[model samples]
Target: MASSNTTLAEASNITTMAGRSNSTEAASPYSFHFGMLLNPDYLLVEAQVIFSALSIIWLGAHASLRRPPSAAHAKPKNGKKKVKDVQFAEGFTASDAIMLPVTAAIVLVGLYYALEWFKDPDIVNRVLRIYLSTVSIASLGAAAGHGLDIITSLVFPGLWVDRKGTLYRVDSDHQHQVKVGEGDVETEVVEIKTPFPSFLSTLPLSHGKIQAAWEIRNLLTEEWTVRLAAHGLGLAEFSIKLNTLLGFLIAISTTIAYNTTKWFFLPNLLGSAACYSSFSLMSPTSFSIGSAILVGLFFYDIIMVFYTPYMITVAKKIDAPIKLVFNTGRGVSMLGLGDIVVPGMLMAMALRFDLHQFYHKQMKLEPIDLVSELATATPGETVMVSETQYRRVKPTYADPEGQWGNRFWTTKLGSLSPVSIATSVRAATAFPKPYFYASMLGYFAGMLVTLTMLLVFNHGQPALLYLVPGVTGSLWLTALARGELKDMYGYTEDGSMDVEDVIVEVDSTGKTIEAVKSTAEEKGETKDNKTGKEAVARTEKGEGDYDVFLFSVTAPRRRAPKRD
Candidate 1:
């Protein structure tokens, strides 16, 4: 009877202990399911980093490939021709560098106070959703276009055709001088009359026919006869190319899916598109400007993250596509867009510097004489004056003759057909990118450090604090080790040091027909027009008693012009 009682007592004690253990686990914050513990959150985090890095690098490479804005000109219209270039965003100025941190502080403080006052983020999110969604559509559309271009270039290089044409103002009916003959049978000059002033003809080539079914008077004043295979597929005014239309459709569909489902991957995809678009639309113009921006933001990030609760609070509460969020088993990890874009601008500038250096090393400038007619005080007579200038030999990439295909299929492996693997390898490894590679390595290391700190402290960390030093330090160190500090400092996107503009007219036969000169007196200009500095002009009698005005002045440090 005593043994039986002891057994019952022991069983009660065991049951009580089990119940206590279950209650403790239920109350603990760290309690998680077995499956949650086994979840591969680290892999997802690594993917986020890789995706961000690739997006930045791709943007930087393409930015380097873009031609100077001045090279592209709109076709002449209505008997008038004007030089116009589109600038997406202004380059960062010194004042902007100074004001960035201050502005961020103000904005963060406002957001924190507002959130505290409301005690609910739903109102703020609703308002932000309206604004951010609109922006996402535009940004995603542009990103889609870029993606289409890249994919087509890699997969369908043969489909691309390069067409050359001249632009002219149509004041009246136009004529073209053409040589008509068979082979070497003594070709005779023939004049062809046409309604348009300029047309480009590729012999024995006609992929499609141009139909002038309807014209919109003033809107259809300019004409382009270039035979590009990728033409529009709709009405003249509302026309969009096939590739462009497809890209827009994809963007729209993705956006709709995101709004409807609100899935995790959708936000990530949209966020990446936004980052790519930002890189495309904005630039730092020079290495110095980029450096200044990065350094300023470094301090801003440190203070907002460590000193105040606003950074983490604002990030968590904000329900927008501005941040990339990864769900870990414990909670969620967030990376802000500013973390990617700010340092990315600097990295992009570094890539451009690499390309600039490559061109400088490979290409040589050829001197050419520009002759212009200057009328003297005596009417009905003019004298010719010639000025010497230099023009750079075009790069191989700029050549339109089978160069695009060559970019992909240059190296052949024994007995292997030209494959897409070559495109990926060549795109990444073809460029000499000491600075870019260094920055990229630094960014990866910084990311690892940030993640480590987050795991150690179990707190939100300022990414830029690590990233800025990593990116900027690596670049500067590489430049120092290579003994290219002088070159690095000298390189700039500012056009102040570039050659002065000269207007030269050429015939279809590639002969210089006329050169136009604008005199300072005619324009009534006593100052340097571009730099807005003081100027002094001196006239001297040249050969044949022609007046030649020589301007000697200092070029002021003007704002760097922006370009895409």
Candidate 2:
């Protein structure tokens, strides 16, 4: 993120003005320099740096650990269902990379001109704040929910379900007939079973009651649903689950407190949340796309910071959560959101790529065909139907149970534990992360250099100028050293690896009765479908077909006489 020294200059100007007004005691230059060196703002800057780095690391870890919605879900067991994760509709493309700098330049120039014409930055800031704050509220809420889950998992490992499973809402009055078999044979109809209330209330301290307070938390968490009705309705609805609602409330409270008291930490918290949410919502998808975006922004940052004043001017003038501002007791030290997000996206991609390599090269789990058999009985006849399908196995790394626990507590003085660490280092370093680690090292070094230059030169520096090269160079170097250039180039987050065969069973009326085995199931287990048919499904090595099967009772009619 860009660190600006414009505030330092302003602080100096104010000091000079104050001295001119007093014209009495002259402060010693040595004392002034010492005070600057010991300024509490320096600690604040360092804290922000650490906070930004940790946020980036967590963002990348989240991207790598999260599985697709279909893969994350588990069968409904005792009224508990898994919560699905939220993801962006589309991944960042190469075209987006190409246009990023151009689009940013246009916005910067437009904002600059608008400021000049209006002669007031507040007008622009107010307009932008309205839109940005609205978005930030949602983003902050989601990020907070995710962070809470992470903390809960780390502290109370295995205490909660891996997917944060919650109780499903029961509708006792709603019922549907489910067909049991294919139409060629005898068909049995069964009523859909309603799930029992969750036993969470049976848990200690009314934990179950706490969980029952929320329903369908995974609906919006996985993806956004859009609805349009032409009749008398013209509205768009977005849903937030319990955790998300809590986060939303927290964000709203923060906004209110900041507006009333002008607290600096509030904005920083909001800005950090926005950055984390941005990483979750969008990613470069691949190293190449990430590199292209960073390189483009590299030049853009240089031009905007060194050649023009729009960057700093806007950063200083805007009174929103777009930038992190630390009150240095003199003025403020600023870090623009762009400085963190642009390079942070690339770092996140690096982590994801590392995970990709780990799953393919280290785990090396092969796809297996799952075959299912179904039988239907009709008048004096029986028909047997067989279907084959394949599903991607969920990785151990994706499992939340004991995944984020600190193992250091198990280490005894007489013995050393393999994963002895006070932090979640065991989980964080569970997979080999050469590229991710390298990029992080580079990022830390670049930040140090940026801050050093800011002090030595006493001027604002474009952070991307250092950060882009540091991250991209480190990644390329690591790739080259590991002889993974080809793999890095070929790797993409297109959901192909995450795809699994889904078997949908339908009734004689062509209505879908149930979906069977969308994800991997334990071997040799018979899965009971809604139609009351127990299908023996097992994994094998062979070609498989997956599709919807509809059974009808009526036989095909004989061909009609020539259609003269």
Residue 239, candidate 2: Cα error in Å is: 9.1
The lDDT of each candidate is 0.53, 0.54
The parts of candidate 1 lying over 4 Å away from their true place are 1-40, 60-64, 68-88, 159-240, 365-406, 409-429, 500-564
Candidate 1 to truth, TM: 0.60
Cα error, residue 327 of model 1, in Å, equals 2.2
Any runs in candidate 2 off by more than 4 Å, and if so which?
1-44, 56-64, 68-86, 151-156, 159-241, 362-397, 400-429, 499-564
Per-residue lDDT tens digits of candidate 1, residues 1-564? Answer: 001111100010000000111334335553323342233655465456556655665664454344331222224544443432335375777677778778877877787788788899888777666667667877777667656655543432321111121111111221222331222122333332222212222233232221121111111222222222222321122223345556678878887787678677887777777777776577777778788878888888877777877776676566777666555443344567777778877787777677556545654445578799999889999999998654444333231222243343333434232233333223333547788888888887777676555434434567787888888889888999999998787766664323323344555664545534335424546333533322212112222322133223222222332221
Clashes of each: 0, 8
> For residues 34-117, could you state the per-residue lDDT of candidate 2 as single tens digits?
343344556465556646655655664554455432233444543433444456555888898769888888887787788889
Residue 197 in model 2: lDDT: 25
Backbone clash total for model 2 is: 8
Report the lDDT of model 1 for residue 55: 66
TM-score of each: 0.60, 0.61
